[model samples]
Target chain A: MSCDHLDLALASGLDLLGPDEAREFALHLPGCPACRAEVETSRLLLDALAFSAAAPAPRPALRRAILRRAQASRWRLPGPVAAVLLVALFCAALWLGATRFPVLPAVTRTASGYIIASLDPTARSPHAKGEVMLLPEAGHILVMADGLAPLRAGRVYEAWLLTRGGAHALGPLHLDGWGYAWLHARVPPGAFRGLLVSVEPARPGPGPSGSTVLATSGDAK
Target chain B: MQEADLPRRLARGDARALAELYDRFAPGVFSLALRRLEDAGAAEEVVQDVFFKIWHGRALFDATRGDLPAWIFAIARNTVYDQLRRRLRQSRLSEAQAAMLDLFATSGFEALEHLMAQEHIAELLAALTPEQRDLVRLVCVDGRTVAEAASLLSTPLGTAKSRLRAALARLRQTLATEVRAQ
Candidate 1:
């Protein structure tokens, strides 16, 4: 019929409707197949983009650059905010760093020789975690210490190679205040099984004695 | 690590990589801002702001927590919204910018109508004169409600609604014809 009146019929909006006009429109939609299709088309498009607005992608370079800028400008953030952000970052980094991939201190193994880095009683880890070492000298093994905190006076440490049979004493490891440590010892042919560090009483003895401080397996490098 | 890797590379001062990312997304960002701000210069500025955010504001982007694209978009969106609010607050539009804004108003609707290939939408848009085409684009593609379009066009709501209804009628008629032909 006369769609000149159709303007009045449609302005109520394709998506929205009032009670009486909506009822009339509903009746007309099923009967008037064309209007039904038209409504369906509009509805489809609207449905296609209902919740989210269609966004064109940003340039990758621009995106990366802007993100970089945003991150940098974060430094320009006000003091309290910056502090809070940093603290949060520091905590996150520390947690991730600690749990995920803690650094493994580098070790140099000598060819044709066995090595070990024994621990002394007062010697402690400079870092929260540390690595003891084994080096080979000819047919013997030289042990080393790395990342251990310096020792306090009136104390010493001992080292032992624990095996399937029992523990063997590698003897006295020494260190001055920090960084890397080198200990000299003979790698008994079978003592190559496992090695450990223990905080021993201040006297040097011919045995793996005193309390076991921090014992670790002495294995092939 | 993959997520942090780029920003970390960027953190140490890599500019070329950032440019690569820029070329990738500029079109979408430009089109988005153009639709919202309706000014080429403002849109360009919006794009620049988006670039600055990704390049210099790497800290704001938590790749571990979110996708880079999403972060970039959020920032771009905020920049556009902020500019919109500022434009609204300004009591007077300098004659030059006002002139540019009016450019989008002229024949703008026809351009949008021409883009409307769907039989139903084409029918709806055919009833509108080129002048009313601008109103339809503002409502549809650019996402303005009729009330918003009326304010934008500086016309009465009744006038805009009337044009909308007429346009919608045309769409139905066009759709009806297309349906019969099919």
Candidate 2:
């Protein structure tokens, strides 16, 4: 194939080429320096791009709309209209409120894929700190501490990665309140396996430092 | 995801699909925009606009038109080009000032490309507007930060940021094209 045709063929969908066109494009690769270089570079870039690694973005709105449209997804009653239902619900609510009702059941959100854990504890009498919130796909993992004594300003609560073998210092998480200290950890491959928080100096290294303030052990959950 | 499946979800106005698509390419896209626009604000605005359009376009996308990434990239490229044309027509920036805006606007992924390219970063300098060429000489060649470059140019920080981002994204795309041509 000529260089122009060869280039056009390469950019066009790979599936569309007949055997001859595909073969002709490959033949041009051997003799043409510019085209050969172009082919190799494009291949490398596309390879590195990991195009197939893309995952489907969850369509929450679509799910909601689908559920709304599909009548089986929700229960609906047609009869005595909204006024009667509102009055009945209001009466029930009032009766419950007047009788010194028990506290309402805790409504908590369920999260997908948690880091589950069980850990070894030192016999030394000490309280372990705990915190939780949504984490992004990247950046420093923010671990926090709360309801604890004020740590020295320069001092931070360092987080640690625990293995059956030993411990690695994650990093010092900045402390905000007795109820809040953030352990900023660089997420490494499998680093999220098990985490321990330590109150180390404002500067902490790759291994655990100072005392363990809050600790958690988790398996993939 | 199966090409057939996305349209159905999108038709229902599923925002999560938009998020998923963003997750797949947004970093590179944003980084590309940042490289061109230099200012994070402009680059971010472009990225957000692209996704917002996709989110609102739930029922509009057709599976047979093209692959999503290339389509998205084309839209992004057009958006950047439109911004450049709009700024040039509206602002009347001087040649010296415009040069500084494009120079040093790139950071995040040019750094990554450098790491991956085995020291062969291709001819980035040759790909520039004359004004951008001057900015390269003054800031990058002289090691000036955005603040330093802005002070030297006697321009507002906002203008500098926008120009820098636009320039960087252009340079990065140019380099990407050149690298592909290798």
Q: Top model by lDDT, which number?
A: 1
Taken in order, the candidates have interface RMSDs of 23.4, 18.1
- Candidate 1, Cα interface RMSD: 23.4
lDDT of 1 by residue, A119-171 (tens): 32223442322233332212233344444555667656566655455565555
- Where is model 1 chain B poorest over a 10-residue stretch in terms of lDDT? B106-115
What is the Å distance of residue B54 in model 2 from its true position? 1.2
Which one is best on TM-score? 1
lDDT of 1: 0.46
Q: In candidate 1, what are the lDDT values of residues B35-117, reduced to their tens digit?
A: 55667678876787556545544433444434455444444544554454345336345443342232222211111121122
Candidate 2 lDDT by residue in tens digits, B1-182: 65456657655545455545666555545554554455666766566545533443322344454345544553444344334433553575444224323321211122122223212222454566666554544443333466677778787766665555455445546655654775
DockQ of each candidate relative to the true complex? 0.08, 0.02
Model-by-model lDDT, in order? Answer: 0.46, 0.41
By DockQ, the best candidate is: 1
Q: Against the true structure, what is each candidate's TM-score?
A: 0.29, 0.28
